[model samples]
Target: MAFINGPVPEALDREVAATPAEFERDLRKAWPQGVRSDASLSLELNDGALRLTILLEPLEPRRIGLLTLPRLCARYRFEGGDERARTALLTRLDRAMQRGGG
Candidate 1:
């Protein structure tokens, strides 16, 4: 009944330079319990009361000079969860998907 875990969004969208397969691997690592839906290219992580659906949309590769990078659009939908729950879960996912170096 108070603002504790900061602000939580019902949905989040992010564009990353990674192929579907690559991102899927990270998704699995982040939430192994999550189920993958190949048909829709989405992942569903649910704990009955708390649910999160991740939609992966592949886009044209970005070319910089002679380099081409894979592109993907990731949409995260927080179906049911508290601020702390959502924040904690998202943090794990973000940490798993995070990449370093230029």
Candidate 2:
């Protein structure tokens, strides 16, 4: 198949060309407890670039003889050169974790 255009214009090319390792190394500096088990964090190094995704499971409905509804799922991603990407991702995940009572 012919391609109309090529890949994205390296939004985070230089900044994250070698960021995956740096991210992992620096995560602990920010969160001393490391990543929690209920949270799923994945970092990918593709074509000399970095991308991060975090998924937090929804809260389970209470089963203590009280009617409860399912919670919403929370997922965040960090891509491109936006300065707030990482901060936003962490904030969302942290909020999710808090909602989960962790």
Scored by CA lDDT, what does every candidate get? 0.77, 0.36
- Predicted structure with the largest TM-score when compared to the true one: 1
State which candidate has the highest lDDT: 1
TM-score of 1: 0.83
Which digits, one per residue and each the tens of the lDDT, describe model 2 over residues 1-102? 011133332232111111233334444344443443222334332111335444334445444467654442333344654444444444543343332122
Query: lDDT tens string, model 1, 1-102?
Result: 012246678887888888888887777877777665677788788865778888999999999999999998888888876877887777767776677766
Clashing pairs in 1: none
Off by over 4 Å in 1: 1-6
> Deviation in angstroms for 97 in model 1?
2.1
